[model samples]
Target chain A: MPTVHATIIARGGGSTFHRKNTCRVLGTPIIAYAIQTCQQAGFIDHVFVWSEDEEIRSIARSLGAHALERPHSMVHYYSGFATQEEWAAQRGRQIEVIAGGPGDVNVAFNCNNFLLRPETLAAMHCQAREDEAVGGVIAVAAVEPGLCLKTRDGSLFPFWNDLSVPRAEHPPLYRRTGVAVTFRERFRNGRMALAPFVVSREEAFDLQHAEELPLAEFYLRKRLGLLDSDRPAAGEGC
Target chain B: MRVTASIIVLERDARDGVRWDARMGGMRLLEHAVARLKGLPLVDELAVLTDCDALCDALGNTLACAGVPVRRLCPTCTTERFDYLTCEESRIRQQLLALEQAGLAGDVHCFGSWRLPLLSTRSWERMYHALLEDRIAARIVPLTTEDPNLYTPLGGDVASGRLFGVWAHPGRDRQEAPQLYRPAEACVAHLGRIRYPQPLTKGVEIAMTEAVTVRTAEDMPLAHFLWARQQAGRACHDSQDGGAGVP
Candidate 1:
């Protein structure tokens, strides 16, 4: 069997932005919570977290996982693909790399996404296992581009080109959820897409902003069967 | 010739102290040691070593009144630098030196304050065997229990956790780490520590279990410790070498 390796990229330093949101998990650093989820899935052969924080490294070690130190230059929030690429290049031994694409697939997840479902994972693994052509599965939620907009260079543009309508009236378009990314070995060779496998949007959610984190947490708590109805949803904007 | 073993209870923080300044302890530590030593048929004679002046005086008075001899040794410190060997070595050396200065000639055994439960008749036999008959390169024995405060909070409540053990070797220097003994493929005996929040077993239990024994300072006789030092000296040959012998 091909060894499955994962890298959870998070600085794990005390974040001024999401202090309350980040402090809820235990046994590992905030980022490692995702790494632990991967470890629990049994699909991962080796799990590593790329972080510059010594405490995070210690946390990973304590969790029985390896830690790859992210260089100072690559750790800045704006410095994107280069960090993931360098991290994958330096430490991608035997396992594949799943690079930047969506927040749900990344390490710093919302608190609500904690009780991730195994079937969703099973569906992806099934695709990867049966179809050699598919690199892996990327969990995604259907979104209507017209319902979302992107602001760049002090201007607002439609999130996707084909959707001419304003985003407020329409439902949100498809967004990739980072719950898990099962990649193939070939994907690490600079290929754009993985051996594609698809799963339900209900199995995924976005956790980009601080407000979205608690929503993810709330949903995750429900998924894990830990909470009952009437619990307030996590992350305000969600 | 009388064989007296100085069991030094060094200060848990210093590196070294004057021969008389080494022995330091209170009534509790000595009482525990004496209780553990009661069953040692071969011990012949034993003394407690401590550095605290008040502590030493009180312990000395207590032990003398109890009919067990006590003496004061130099001050020594405790450290976790390498399994606490530095602290163990200093205490052992201080006690030995105190015995020598007091004009008490005997084969003295030195122990640390933390080594209370490890000093029993069964352990004495094993140490004697390792030194005299077994002729083993190195023998590390296990302690009956681990520090409940650090490793196991409930004190062995978890059934399948790592088996806790202490190391024991005759003539091995406490300064040297266990890595040095790896070359000999040393013999290690794993002994379980009695569960915490409960009293320690009355004596060492030799029933079989799986554990690794490394070397600790509490297992050597004064003569063996002296021999180890001499061997280290011989191996040094030249003072520049700074002997790293079996001790």
Candidate 2:
């Protein structure tokens, strides 16, 4: 079996919420959940926290995971100069630096998504391994379909022909969950034939706002069986 | 500036053969919309645009009951039936032309939809003020905050099943992501400044609660619930103030 590594991308500074990776959700740092999931997965050989912040790295080390100091250049700040393809190439470079071997597989996990399950990670790895032609397998969540539109020059324009049609008849939509498994070789080459691994919307919830933290805590407490019929005491599980 | 507020009713607003007459909190959705617009002091004139004669009669009754003067606008189109998705812009243009012909076209035009019963008077004022600012042709209300990172197109690559053209922000921080504004239910515009194809636009951010737009039968309950909650909140505040009520 090839070496499978899980890298938790926990950047210290967030534009919306500061130090979100280290932000507490049900008494545990958000990054800890991703690390714990990776550690619990049977197929993953190593779990590493890649971050630019010392506090986040220290937290990762305390949680029994390897801490990698990510360079500032790899920490992407949107300048509008680089296209998305260029950003992908830069990500490929970052992956190559972390997992150098040809056969080694790197699983990228966003630390903010605390609800990811070990089974889901293992399933994605197994799918990627079973399909040799595929470069990676990414987690996607279904989006509620409706009448989508775009605005141009202060005017609304519909993407579809008939707005009178029922919303249920619209085609289904899915979005990337920022979780994936990529082989080292596939990262080196620009062309990656990626496969889709469907996940529940709860598992794909990425914490970006302060209001969402309490909701995430609610879900986490529910998962841990700490929640009762009545409202649980504040910091009960913590 | 002369300001004209138009309550736009389209055939597409019908759900289960019911038009904007759908009731919420014991009042028709159209009534709630008209009452809200009627309360705005910035509005110099009020109008209703629709092709349905029955809807026009209903609007006349609604306005008469409210004791507000309104110009009923019936925009004549070349096509017998206008498909909203395909001809929304043309319909709006025709409405504006009708307003112009009636000499009721104000320097500033505010368009309200009957579907948006919860859009607050404060939000309308925000857009109106934003439009009044120099060089702004249009002002629209946007959702409080929406992360662009989560969106993906409908389909993916045929062979690999990988989502193509997915734009993910490089940074984990959402602020690093591009700011995108999805317009809410109402729009305010300076009629003179608007150009043919494109116009300079500004955005006024409103709370997510104020952005409820009822599009389907399923949405009516949520709108009604929200309306009830607002009324309850207002009542509680009024009693707390010794029944003096909001100024």
Candidate 3:
């Protein structure tokens, strides 16, 4: 009976550097999508957006998420295992103020991520619920079987696999998506207890460059009805 | 507007001995259709009218779990494979009867189940808006394909975009002979009821400018390749995000 809570890390520069979580594609701000996906996940008890910018925090709050001003020092730090652990602790403290207790499951969800499906969040929650002993689960993409390792001497051979013999014989392989991680409070070392939640390559896409905006808009429009809001804009031209 | 999206599944079985319900991208074609439709935000309810036991068996649990209302518009009718146009006429007629029986009215979007594996969410959205925009003048907007493979067997005009019906009268529905050519992601919208054998009277048409249909065995490879390329491109983007405000 552990409460599931989520914290979205969304402090980015702006459209100026392509770091701004507010940098919008298809009319909706990028961070808004973070809030949206969290809502879709269904199991979250609380959704919080961590940011330093007043505008970004405003947007997050407007989109129905709790906003916390992030420390300037933590802004530029690349988040992975260490950041995830720290964020979980911060989340525990935040939840304590409201409910006077910490959730059993804490999710450190990163921004610039639009591809994670709601089912993914539900799956992570199910994992924690199924095994009280389970520590954490990180989103990963499964590489379609048939891969190999090559030596510096230019040798190519399957790595602990006989997949080359027949394509059907190979099993699935996973690679970290670096998007979202849900974990139990006590065991915060996500990398150690990393239960992989497999995502497709589409779900692995993370925005980094301004040039990728048009492309991201294209795909987002396909996935989300991003352009539905722009029907009026399109009507003007028609 | 509440959209009554009718998902039509034609009957298929092991009796055909043709894994016509072929597996692609790790799912049976019917399964992909059911899964993708579950994501559409515009659809208040999905009306799945099919006599095909396979579609029902494959989708029954998933649809039920999703909590979407489903109707099995019964008396599962079969179409003659030899007469393409006649089969299409029957196909649409079946959809119309199914919607009517389900007691669904107001803004209807109907498309073939086979088209499900290929059509993107954006296409469905466009189809929705197109219907709303033309509800004033047009009675039904037939979702037409563009040039390069409009269902020509049905006498779809390669010049403009006229299929068998909907412009004049479905029996001979075309405003002008050799209408504008268009087809794929085939669909039609109605304000309330779809009256066939009558001149379309007044209806605006929207053309989906992409090819995402699985009509024959030859189309499978192309559809599979296109889907694969799309996925590969999605997984290839990397974030070089360099900002302190991680919002």
Candidate 4:
């Protein structure tokens, strides 16, 4: 059987939402959700949390996940001048260094995307492992049509010529989410043939802004059955 | 910079079945559009571009009564074999030429009568200033929404049905995704730099509520509701300021 490894990348110093990964959601740290989900996933052989922050690493260790200390150089690999291929090459090298060696199958999860269920992760892993043609499987959500683009001379033009047509008849647009499963060889190749695993818009929500924290909590509470009207008030714990 | 505001009222089969003269908020939709443009201090001249003769006469009488200096222009180009967009483009070119010949210079801001009812004068002012500051040929208003979904273009390979390029990985701290900006129905263009078949560029972003364009009769109620809501908010704001009177 191929070894399925899950890596939850939680870096510190986010300008948008400070210490977002360590921030509590329904009493537990947000990063704990991804760690716990990976631990619960039967298909995943090992779970790792890659971060440079000592506090985040400590939390990962407490959550029964191996804490991989990320290098400073790896953390600052982003460059506006670098091409996509160059960035991918850099990413491949970084992953290889963190994982010790390129494993059989690698599943990546963003700590901010707390809504990702274990079942979804397992399914993605299975799909990536089973399909030879697929380089990787990533979550994507459908985008609505009837958008317009502005011309340089400031005239409005429709993305879809006819807004009168039924939505079903219009061409579909998909948005890529921050969750992916990749094979060892595909990860190193730089060029990946990604297959889209359709997920609901709610499932793909990433906790970025401080304003979104309440919404994320609401969804998490709803998922935990804490929001159920019939549930006993005293028994409620998420 | 001298600015000429053109209120474009095209005579075509409106998919929403709403005509330019349709009643909206106790006034004709065209009248609301005209009134909005007339209030803009930056605009040096005003012109109405339409195909209908009766509309010109009716609007002429109204403008004459109000003592506003206005120019009425009719497109001499034959509409035969021309689609809606092509026909509209032709009419705009004709109107711009007329304005140029009549000694009008600088930027020509075109306002579609359909969109003017909802857009605020503040938005127009911002667009004009942006145009001047940016030194760009035109300035457009982008429709804003809270939907956080970032999109990717579909690959041409129909058989595989795979997404084209490598996307932002989950490992990255700041995931960058391609943003699609939908244009709201308003734009300012410089007469000197005007080019046919203009390429798309970035525009000023506005709130989704403020970007509502009334396409059909069904959209009328929503427009009315929004307009009333805006008025109510303004009145409340005035009351809070101890009734300082309108600005």
Model 4 error, position A187 (Å): 6.7
Q: Model 4, stretches more than 4 Å misplaced? A: A15-20, A23-29, A79-103, A145-171, A185-192, A206-238, B1-139, B143-161, B166-202, B206-247
The 10 consecutive residues of candidate 1 chain A with the worst lDDT sum are: A146-155
C-alpha lDDT values of all predictions: 0.39, 0.65, 0.51, 0.62
Off by over 4 Å in 2: A1-3, A22-47, A52-104, A112-123, A140-175, A185-191, A197-238, B6-11, B14-39, B44-89, B97-105, B114-120, B136-163, B166-180, B195-200, B205-247
Best by TM-score: 2
Each candidate's DockQ: 0.01, 0.15, 0.01, 0.14
By lDDT, who's the top model here?
A: 2
Q: How many Å off is the CA of B132 in candidate 3?
A: 57
List of clashing residue pairs for candidate 4 = A152-B199, B16-B216
Candidate 1 is graded, for docking, as incorrect
**Against the true structure, candidate 4 has what lDDT?**
0.62
Cα lDDT for residue B42, candidate 4: 78
Of 1 and 4, the candidate ahead on TM-score is 4
**Under CAPRI classification, how is model 4 graded?**
incorrect
Tell me the lDDT of candidate 2. Answer: 0.65
lDDT of 4 by residue, B1-247 (tens): 5677766655652434888777766777767667766778878876665555666677657765765433544345324211122224554576456556534545555444545576777767766666566654343444553333434446433234475433233434333533345556566665555544552233666654466567677556545655555565666788898773321
Residue A8 in model 2: shift from native, Å?
1.8
In angstroms, give how far residue B200 of model 3 lies from its true place.
Answer: 66
Error of 4 at A104 (Å): 3.2
TM-score of chain B of 2: 0.80
Q: Candidate 1 — what's its lDDT?
A: 0.39
